[model samples]
Target: MKDQITIVGNIGSDPELRRLADGTPIASFRIASHERRYDQKTSSWVDGTPSWYDVSAFRSLGEHVLASVKRGQRVIVTGALTIRRWENGERSGTAAEIEATAVGHELRFGTTVYTASAPRREEPAPPPADAPDPEPVAAGAWAAPGAETPF
Candidate 1:
């Protein structure tokens, strides 16, 4: 089973984008999610320790992340989670990571304008030289009575 998780956090650093030898692109960054609590005695809000996660996005998503995300920006990321432990000499630590499937701005903090990307397509092959021509449709032939044609 896959361990999937979603996190809302502030980006800790600019995304680093790189390409593999096969030309596949990947972007990596870190995010810190802090917990806020109300302290009754102090009568104030306090910030708890933050949980940090390293995130990576691949392919077109990576390209878009490199172009759109920045350090300190609030974002929402959803992906598969991974935890790893490592030791160097006598020191050891655990690392949390996410292989992000989706990354986007957290709109509660701000607004963003979205632009649609162009659709990808391959050129259609030319018809065979000896093929018969296609039949032409009469103007408004497919339109119902009293219905306006989109064209």
Candidate 2:
């Protein structure tokens, strides 16, 4: 996989939002990017094969995606790509996904207003001294982003 990947495409589905018991937010969606080619026989441009990516964002980035992105909206995503193979009851296939670090509206498609949010603290807040450590949240309880999640 590449160290980093940048893709510009339209959101293929609505962003699914959820929060961990501790209040950390998560957002996920699918993006479809296509290549266009000029066909001499057709005498016009034609769409080549489309590539789909299952994208996920976490914490404040996740919150931003949930609030901003929507189905069919053009956007830019910068992230890391991971590939996996799975076998389920005799069904097997490969999956491609992106762990998005940044997501935003594609300015080339149209104009959009931007509201910058405050930055997060460098150090996470410690739980109250009197409070017990909270249990980790299970991913199974929440719906996976897109058709699958990179667990």
Candidate 3:
């Protein structure tokens, strides 16, 4: 089973958008998620250590994220989680990353206006230059053969 996680946090950096040689877009950003505990003695909320995660979104989702997300914005991200250990010149650390499946603003922080993207439609191929034009039909001639037109 794939490991998945959902996190609500503030974006730690601006989303970086890049295109691969194949023209596929990918966006990456950092998010800081932390816990807040209410202390009755202090009568206030105390913040815990922040956990950072790198987030990546691909294709149209990446494009949308590049257009919509910004640094310091509160957002919710859900995706597959991956942890990798890397070493460079004796320095080694585990990095956490998420391949985002869904991303959106955290509504509790503020209101956001949503705009739906229009479906992409491929243009019809042009007719061949040597192709003969079909004969024109009279108005209301769309009725099937032997069927009477309602108009």
Candidate 4:
């Protein structure tokens, strides 16, 4: 089985979304995770070297990510890690990447409001010119006031 990686960090930049030729959506962004160590001398926690990673998410998840995530927001991501070696002239380095399977905001640091997105549905064809206008329906129980609850 392939190894999976999970990282909890702050997004270092705004997510960029794109579509492949076949119309598959993808979103890419950078994340920075840091380790803290306690120092007896200063008696305080200090940040160690931060690890930076490139994260890519695809399809509907990518769409949702683009809409929900933003720079500096804490997030948790899980996916397969990919390492690639590269060289240019006399310089060489290894690139770290994650093909993200899941991504979401980390709520421990703050609060967020959750709203359900409207479901997608195909519209019916327009009625004949002689057809009467459809009657409007009243908002149902689902739309009742005070329906939203804090997470």
Candidate 5:
């Protein structure tokens, strides 16, 4: 997989939390972003592309998003694009969605979220206190970012 993605927009709506038939928790929300263009004549703000995306987060991630994220809050979404189709008797429409893996408050955009009540991700148990540290390795032994390993 390429792991290719686009990101970082403000939330357009409140995240709605719900469950599936199998009882997995999930939340859905929308993020709206504006695209701008340079106008040589007016040299002013010109509205370009306005995109709205439907985002879904699962399990504890979903709950955290619902509890911490709010309308007009900025967020960065990273997930592969998915197309969902639904029907209701005589009408149907397709949805473009992103299954969010990570989300963060856009502090740069004046959105602040205190995650005191949000569920934290479970961390792996640390090694026993008696364990010794491994010797440090030389540089260039690990693969660079986005580069394949020699092994």
Candidate 6:
């Protein structure tokens, strides 16, 4: 699609907030996307090119973004690209922008990590006050990491 965009990058600086004429909120930041090249003989990775993107979040996302996100944090932003035209000192230029909607933390290269967020509260009743904590499970107790699954 012409408007589709997906970006994974490190935050360049803390997000800044602005207000529209009608009081709409706008949050803007710079993202630096990096790539690495691998050397077959050396079995090592070398630094590669990086592309910078300018992103913006609006409304509630904008209001909370500045406080929740920080510079240098790695994140994945999914949104659409909009080509905006504006005049700069009598000169016109096009700018690339992503109206971010879904933002997530990206896992490391070749590694899959799942995060469990805050637990929900049950309305019926709380757990027994004297209930003992669950036993600690050993790493090997569960399936081995990267183990093959037979279907």
TM-score of each: 0.78, 0.73, 0.79, 0.74, 0.63, 0.60
Instruction: Tell me how many residue pairs clash in candidate 4.
Output: 0
- Clashing residue pairs in candidate 1 are none
Candidate 2, poorest ten consecutive residues by summed lDDT = 141-150
- Displacement of residue 51 (Cα, Å) in model 4 is 0.9
TM-score of 6: 0.60
Please, what are the lDDT tens digits per residue for candidate 4 over residues 1-151? 4569999999999999999999999999999999889999999999989899999999978888899999999999999998889999999999899999999888899887777677666787989999998776455544444444344
- lDDT of candidate 2 over 1-151, digit per residue (tens): 4568899999999999888899878898999999888999979999878799999899889988998889999999999998889899989988778999999898986989899787554776877899987777566654532334436
- TM-score for candidate 5, residues paired by index: 0.63
For candidate 5, the per-residue lDDT at 116 reads 56
Local accuracy of candidate 5 as per-residue lDDT tens digits, 1-151: 3244567777989999999999999999998767767888998879767677888899988988988888977778887777779899999988667888887786775757365554455686898999899666557766544344777
Model 3 misplacement above 4 A: 122-151
Cα error, candidate 2, residue 9 (Å): 1.3
Worst 10 residues of 6 by lDDT: 109-118
Clashing pairs in 3: none
Question: What is the C-alpha lDDT profile of model 1 across 21-110, one tens digit per residue?
Answer: 999999999999989899999999999899999999999889999989999999999999999898999999999999999999999989
Per-residue lDDT of 1-151 in model 6, one digit per residue for the tens?
A: 5497888888998899999999999889988888878989899998678777788999877766765677988888988888778898979977777889866666673333455444444566666999898676565543544444454
Candidate of highest lDDT:
3
lDDT of 6 at 121: 48
- Kindly report which residue pairs in candidate 4 clash with one another: none
Taking every candidate in turn, the Cα RMSD to the unseen true structure, in Å, is: 5.7, 13.7, 8.1, 6.6, 8.3, 11.4
Candidate 3 lDDT over 1-151, as tens digits, reads: 5599999999999999998999999999999999999999999999999999999999989999999989999999999999989999979999999999999999996998898797676787999999899677676675645446576
Q: How does each model score on lDDT?
A: 0.92, 0.87, 0.93, 0.89, 0.79, 0.78
Model 5 alpha-carbon miss at residue 78, Å: 0.8
Off by over 4 Å in 4: 119-151
